[model samples]
Target: MPAVTRERALEAAVELLGAEGVRALSHARVDERAGLPAGSTSNWFRTRRALLSGIVDWIAERERADLEPGAMPTISGIDELIEGMCVMADLQTGPFAARTRARYALFLELADDPELGEPLRRQRREFERWTERIVIALGIADPVPATRALMALGDGLLLHRLTVDPELDMRPAIARAVRALAS
Candidate 1:
């Protein structure tokens, strides 16, 4: 077999996180998942933290792409903005829900570890920037407040979904929050 490239290894890492949670994402496990030799991942990443940083960057890029221009459009008015946010919430609460939860759990784990905290903090900042852009595009007069509210709402909804019925439709809950914010 050919050598496992960085991208391939990161992809395997993301899938492994989705399948077996963050604890299963060591260099050795990623190497095994990618069908590479024992030391291949270490050769590329040097350490588990390095590999995790790469994985976090990869996932952030993917999520940013998914939320960009066409995927997440700004609306003309408050009603439309609410609708758009509802759709965004639905997207998170739907097929990608498990991955989101897994990512958040990994984030929490990183938060407790000093070595990983900076990278996770950087990721959160990037996400906040993205949310600010979305809020501005949505035509909110003060995007920062709306952005903060939306972030809170999104986090709360995700936590609720994870703790309660994973199958619960989040549209109504999100719609209510969006309307409250847009008003």
Candidate 2:
């Protein structure tokens, strides 16, 4: 049998997490999903924690990739920054919604686990840093609080859609938050 690539394993893990939640993410399960032998996933990720960490890394990479470059450039206004964030939120909800939802669920599951909590804390810090950078570039005098508020709002929107109504759109609400902040 051919060796399974790490990317293939991660993709399968993400799919499993999305389909059946994090409890279903085992080496055997990932191997089955990736069409590899039962131990193939273990060869790359020795433990379930390692696999979960990989999934977190994958989520971070996807989030970074979703960011708009042009919007990050230094600007003297908040409107463009908010618009860029809205665009990023839209992009996240489009092709990446499933993975995003999976990550959110996993985050909640791992929130109480000491082994995983530290990494998640670090990831949240990085996310806040990115938001801070964007807000600063947009010339906001107080970026930290605003960025945190925006992030909380974004998370709320994502969760509301995932749990309540798949058809619900949060872009307008996000836009309104932006407008309110800028006012």
Candidate 3:
């Protein structure tokens, strides 16, 4: 049998975690989910910790790709930023919902492990920097804190939409928050 690629294993792991929760994630489960040989996933990721680490790395890569130039609308002001963010909110709960769910599941599962959680933290920090640049361009007096606040609000809204109310309209809330932060 051909050796299973790391990407294939991580993709299956994300699907399993997103659909069935963290408890359903295992080397054997990933192998079965990926339709590979019995030990394919284990061959690539010998331990659960290693497997999870690889998953986070893969998630970060995918998100970064999504944010690459031309992938997102150019942000020039508060209004444009809000529009872009609302679009992101839609993507988070729509097309990429499974990836969002998997990310949250991993966040909760690895909260106490700084080592395992560092990749997630790093990803968030990178996002913060990107948002900070936008907020600064919007002429916010204190862009750093405002950027943090906006990101936290967005995360909260996405979580609520995902876990509590699927019908939630996040645009108005995001718009208000962006306006307040920018002002």
Candidate 4:
């Protein structure tokens, strides 16, 4: 069995957030969802801020793993780069779906509280850096502009899937968008 830890509790919280939205979150709820003994989650996350931070940490950890040195696909050109984008889309619709929903819910929460925004701000910077590298590898003259564009596009596609089109095929669409970036 997986060892019980703070991270484990956070993962359960992510699932709870996805399944029941932000209102369902609580130390007791997390412990119940995580299958730990009563009071376990509260022991790890003593306050709402601590729990939100843990959720943010969980999102950040998954994102980091997705873009880690060895996990990333090699980008020889626009095609490969688009493939990577498709991969990102695949993640949102696949195993990461719940986490993605939980992240959006957290995004909304962050807007109402600056104190809870640090992890999100840092995560955005890291994602931007990753996008910048992809833009540079694509031989784009201005990485910042292209990176912003691609990030927006990906976000839009993801948002659409999460809210409007559950069956949307993001690969071909992302390929087209990335190809435009190369042109």
Candidate 5:
């Protein structure tokens, strides 16, 4: 079992990351946000890298949980798949907005400093592989390339929506892509 303190610290890190950018992240901020003793976060994460790693772990687990049945995406059919795509594209504007922003915050930082993105990329690859499975299960003839296409499209949609238009609704386009892939 994971240590409760570590989890608490990571959760606080998520909140801090969401509320502020990565520049604001530090042992002291996390400890204060988590309501822990001054040195508690430092005990768990001796360095900034370790702290980031923990946040990545927490995000992976949290996103996976959010993907469970009855949660976001709610994948069951093509329509649900479309909803899932839209949900992800719309991640920056809801109750989970802060965490969504936090995830992107990491992505922004990693873009400039690629090394720090290893864990983030690993988590993303896992999701892409899962998407590959879903595409294959749908009887798509070209599952590998199809998975790449879908992921790219989803990523593009998310990035565009977040940066260009917060109200941008690409569900129709996403649905069209799904139909094209299925056909």
Candidate 6:
């Protein structure tokens, strides 16, 4: 087998955290879960803190990909933006649920560690910048605040769906809020 890459190790760590929570994380465990040889994760991440920090950076990288030009769904108007956001919510709470859960778990897990938490802050700011552009295009008077509110609403809806109501359809509520914001 090929030598395990850092991404492979970080992906395994995220999967483990999502499936089993933060308590189950360890270099050896990540190696075992990744099907890599012993010490593979340790070779990439010398310590648990290093692993956690790597995980945060890796997750942020993945999330940031969605904001790349042309990576986002076509949104020529507020309605399309709302639909795109609902699709995003669906993805976060559906097919990509594991990663989403792992993200939130890590958010809470490393909330106090400013060193490790910086990646999360950077990711949020990047997302806000992307969203602010969309809000500006949609003609919001205060795009910055509007973008923040939109992001907060989406996060809240995602948390609700992930933690409390897996069956909840968030599109309608998202539509209403998006319209309100656009108005």
lDDT of each: 0.73, 0.74, 0.88, 0.83, 0.79, 0.87
- Could you tell me every candidate's TM-score relative to the true structure? 0.75, 0.80, 0.92, 0.91, 0.76, 0.92
At residue 11, what lDDT does model 6 achieve? 85
Off by over 4 Å in 4: 1-3
Off by over 4 Å in 5: 1-4, 66-77, 88-93, 108-116
Tens digits of per-residue lDDT, candidate 1, 1-183, equal 234477778777877886688777789888898887788878878987788777777777777677567876656666665676667666666766655765786787677776655655666677788877756776666788888887888788777766687776767777777677656
* lDDT (10s digit) by residue, model 6, range 91-171: 998888888989999889888888898887888888888888888887987887788889989999999998899999988
lDDT of 6 at 141: 78
Q: Write the per-residue lDDT of candidate 4 for residues 5-105, one digit (tens) a residue.
A: 67679889999998889999999989888888898887877898888987887788888787788887877788788888888787886789889889888
Give the lDDT ranking, best first.
3, 6, 4, 5, 2, 1
Choose the strongest candidate by TM-score: 3
Number of backbone-clashing residue pairs for each candidate, in the order shown: 0, 0, 0, 0, 0, 0
Residues 61-89 of candidate 2 have per-residue lDDT tens digits of 76555444653444356666656666656
User: For model 5, where is the 10-residue window of minimal lDDT?
Assistant: 67-76
In the order shown, what is each candidate's alpha-carbon RMSD?
Answer: 3.2, 3.0, 1.7, 1.9, 3.5, 1.7
By summed lDDT, the worst window of 10 consecutive residues in model 1 runs over 115-124
Worst 10 residues of 6 by lDDT: 1-10
Which candidate wins on lDDT? 3
Cα error, candidate 2, residue 128 (Å): 1.3
The CA lDDT at 111 in model 4 is 87
Residue 34 of model 2: what lDDT?
Answer: 82
